[model samples]
Target: MFSIKSLHKIIFAISFTALFVVWQWYFVKSVFNFDFLARPILADGFCKDCNVILISLDNLRAKSLLCYGYEKNTAPNLCSFAGKSYLFKNVYTPSSKTQDSHFSIFTGLYPISHGMTVPFTSVLDSNIKTLPQILASNGYTTLFSGPKNDPHLPLDRGFERGFSYKDKGDEPRYWMDNMKKNNLLNRKFFAFLHTYRVHEPYIPQKENINKFYPGGPLIYVTRNDLCKKAYIKLLSQYPDRFKNLKVLNDDYCNIYRDYNTKYAATWNVEIESYLARLDPYWDAFNNLDFLVKKEYTHALYATSIYEMDLELKKFFNELENNKLLDKTIVVITADHGEEFFEHGGHSHAANLYNESIQVPLIIYIPKSKSQIVEKLASSVDIMPTILSILGIEAPEKITGIDLFSSKENKFVLAQHVTANLETIITLKWKLILNGDEKELFDLTSDPEEQIDLSIKNTNISNDLENKLNNYLFRLPKYNSIKSEPFPTWIDEEQRKKLIETGYF
Candidate 1:
C-alpha cells in the first residue's frame, strides 16, 4: 500500500477524473444552461384560455416608430397601443435575415443553435420544436398568414407543421375575414400575422404619403426617368467607375424593369425598389445628391409605416368589436430592422449593425400594468416568454428566458453568418467580431455606434471575445441537428417573389 509507483498511479487517475468532471460541468453550463438570476415562476394555466396573436412586421425598425423616439409619428396606432402595453426599450434580433431571425423567434434558439443562420439557404433543424407546434398540442388553434410564395417561409419547409389554417396573402383584413368565415374566432388560438408591406419598395397609398411627405405624390414614372438619367450622367462623368454598368434589352430604361412584366400591374413599384435593383451598380447613385436620396427614402419608409399602423388600428378595432380584445394577448415585433445605408448597406442580411438588429418588442397582456421595460431582450426570448405567459413549459434546452421574470441574462448575442459577423451586446457595451477584426462600442454613450473603442478598451474587448468564442465552440458539441440545403421544390415563380421582396 505504501509502494511509490502504485501511489503515483492512483493520484494520476484521480487528477484526470477531476479535470474531466470540471470540463463537463463547464461545457454544460456554457452550452445548455441559459444563465438566469433566478428560476422563473411557472404560472401554469394562468392564461390557458387566452388567445395569442403575434404580429411580425417585416423589416420594421424600432427607430421608425414614434414610441421608440422617431422624429415623425410614423405609427400612431402602435404608439397608442404601446401606451397600454409593455414596451421593451432594447430588443435585438438574433440575426438580421428574415428566415434566420424568425426561426429563432419560433424555436427560442439562436442561429448557432437552430442552424438557420444562412438566408434562403439553411433549413431549420427537424428536431427543434417550434412554438406553434407546442401551442397547437396544448389545444390552441394555430394559424399563419403571410406571403404565400415567400421563399423564406415555405410551408413545406417545416413552417406549416402545426398551422391548422394558413393564408396565401399578408393582408390583415383577408386573414380576419377568413378567420370569421371559418368560425375560428371563437376558439383558443395562436395566430401569427406577418407582412412585407412596410418592407422594401415602400409604396404607401397616395393619402398616406401626403400625410408624411407634403411634397406631392412621388410619381413612379418621373422617379424612374430621373434615376435612369442620373445613371446615364454618372456613366459619362465617371467612365472608369461605370465602365461595367449593364444595360438590359439594350435600353437603359429597361435596366430597372420588373423581373416579371405580367405581374407589374399588381406589383407595387417605387423609387426604392428601382434603387435596390441597381445592385452592383450602387455606385451609379453617386451622381445623385446623398442628402436628397436619404430624405426621399426616409419619407417613403415613414409613409409605409404609417399605412401599416392604420391597418393595425382597424384590425384591433375589429377584435374589440368581436369582444375578443380583453381575452387576447398581442405580441408585436419585427423579424429584423432595415438598414438605410447605415453602414454602407442598403438592406438587411448585410450586417449586424444596430439598424439591422434592433427591433421593437411590445407585449399586450390583458389586465397587466403598462410600463416601459428597460431590460435588454432578444428575438429568441419570444417563444419562451409567450409559452410562460400561456402557462406552458418551454423546452428544457432552449436558450431564452421568460422576459417577464426577474431572471436576467448577462448578454445577448446576434450574428449574420452570411456576412461572417457576430456580436455580443450587454446593456452598455457591444463587441462586434468579424474574423480577426473587432469593434467595441459603448451603447450608453454612443447609441449610434459611431466610434470604435476596441483598441482603447482592450480589456473589455478581450473579455467579450473570449465569452463569445466559448459559447460558439460549445454549441456544435451540443447541437445534434445540422442545417439542410435549400429545397429544390421551390419553383421559379416563388423565386421571383422572393426577389421582389428583396430577399435575392
Candidate 2:
C-alpha cells in the first residue's frame, strides 16, 4: 500500500534524526559535562526537625579507619556506624591545612574561592556565607566546640559569625553535659565538634599507647622533635659533608638547649612540661635508628586514633541515652589527613599527595538504607550536601553540588597555596603540578601514587594539566584579609605550639 520512494524517504528521515540525537548528546557531554543519567534527589524534607552534628576529626586519614579497610580495629564505633550509614569511599579535602580545608567544608567553596588558601594567615572573606549562618537563619541554634585560642579558626576570620554558643575545649563529655544543662539539645540545633585528639604529638593514654606500640614513651617523640634529632645526628655524623660544620659542636647544642628554655618560659604549663622532657635527651635520642623511630611514631599515631574512637563511642552513647540518635544527622569527616614519611614527608601541608588529602566522610541519616557511595566528593561538597539534606537552599554562588542528586564531579581540584602546588584528580588519573614540575599517576593502578607516569604518558598528563589550568583560571577570587601580626611572645608561643603539633 506504500510507495517505495515514500518508504525510502521515511527511513532516511528516521536515520537523520537518530544521528542528530547522537551528535547532540556527545556535544553536550564533551562541552558542558552533562550527565544523562543523574539520580533524582532522595528523601527531600524527610527530617525537617532533625538536628545536625558535624564532627571534624583533625588530621584523620581514611586509610587508618577500620571502615575504610584498615587491618586494625582502630575505630570500632565508626565502623559500626558506617555499616548503617552512607560511607563515601573517595572523599578528598581541597587543602591539606586545617583552616583551608575547614573553610571549604563550611563555605562550600574551595580555598582559592574563599580566600583562605594560606594556613593560619589568610582569613575567610567576611562576605562569604557559611553553613552555620544558613542553618541559624533557618531557626536552628548553632554551637561550636574546639580548641581555645585556635589560630586556625580565629574569631576574626568569620568562624564565630553564627554560633549562639561556643565552647573553648575539645571534650565530648563536657559538650554533652553543657548541652543537657542548657537544654539546647531539645530544640533543633547544629553543633560542630572538632578535635585534634587524632592529630600528632600523638599522646594517648599509656595503656592505649602500649596496645599499639609495645615500645614505651621513651621512643615516642613528636614528629618535629624526631626531625630535629635526625638533623642534629646528620650534622654530627657528616660534619665534613656540610659547608657550615662549626655549628655542629657541643657548645652549639648547649646554646640551642638554653634558647629552648627561654622560649618555653612563654608557653603554657603543659607545653613547658613537654619541652622539659624534649630538650635534655637530644643527643641520646638522636642515636635511635631512623626506621625504628618512624615505626614507633606510626604506632603512636595509630594508638591516638584508637583512643579518639573510644571518645566517639562515648559521645554517641550519650546521644542514644538522651533519645536523640534518631533525631540527628551525624556527619563525621576530617579537615585533612596526616602523612607518615610517605614521599619523604613527615607531616601535612607540604604536599598535595593522597596521604595528606584523602579523609573519611560518613553521613548517618536516620532510617536511610546504608550503602557505599564510590562517587568523588570534595570538602567543598559538604555544606551543600548538608543544606540539601535539611531541605534548605544553598547560597547561589557556591561551587559545589548536592552529593545525593547531582552527578559525580568530573574532576576534583586541590591546592596547597603556600607550596604553590595544585592537583586535579579524575576517577582513574591524578595530575599534580608545582610551578613547572608535573607528576601524573594512574590512580586505578597505583593508589599509593608511587609511580610517576608523566613522562611515559605525556598525552594523559598534558590533558589533565590543561583541564586543571582551565578549572583554576575560572574560579572566582576573593579579597583575603590577612591575620593580625602577633606580639613577639605570642608569636613564639604559637610557633612552639605548631612545632609540637608537627606543623614546623
Return the TM-score for each candidate structure: 0.77, 0.82
lDDT of 1 at 102: 86
Q: Looking at model 2, which ten-residue stretch has the lowest summed lDDT?
A: 265-274
Per-residue lDDT of model 2, residues 1-504, tens digit only: 779999999999999999999999889878766644455545446666689999998999998887887778888887888888889999989988888888889999888888875434566777788998989999998888887556577655788778888876686556686566556777999988888887655657766677766646655444444435534644464445333334344344443444334444333322333343344333333566777656666777888888878888888889889887788999999999988766765557468889899999998888787889999999899998888888898898888878877567899998877667799998899999989988999899999999999999999988999898888889887777777543343347545645433332
lDDT of 1 by residue, 93-164 (tens): 998878778888999888778876544455556678899999999999988888765546756566777888
- Model 1 stretches astray by more than 4 angstroms: 1-45, 119-121, 217-287, 476-504
Worst 10 residues of 1 by lDDT: 262-271
- Residue 202, model 2, lDDT: 69
In order of listing, the candidates' clash counts read 0, 0
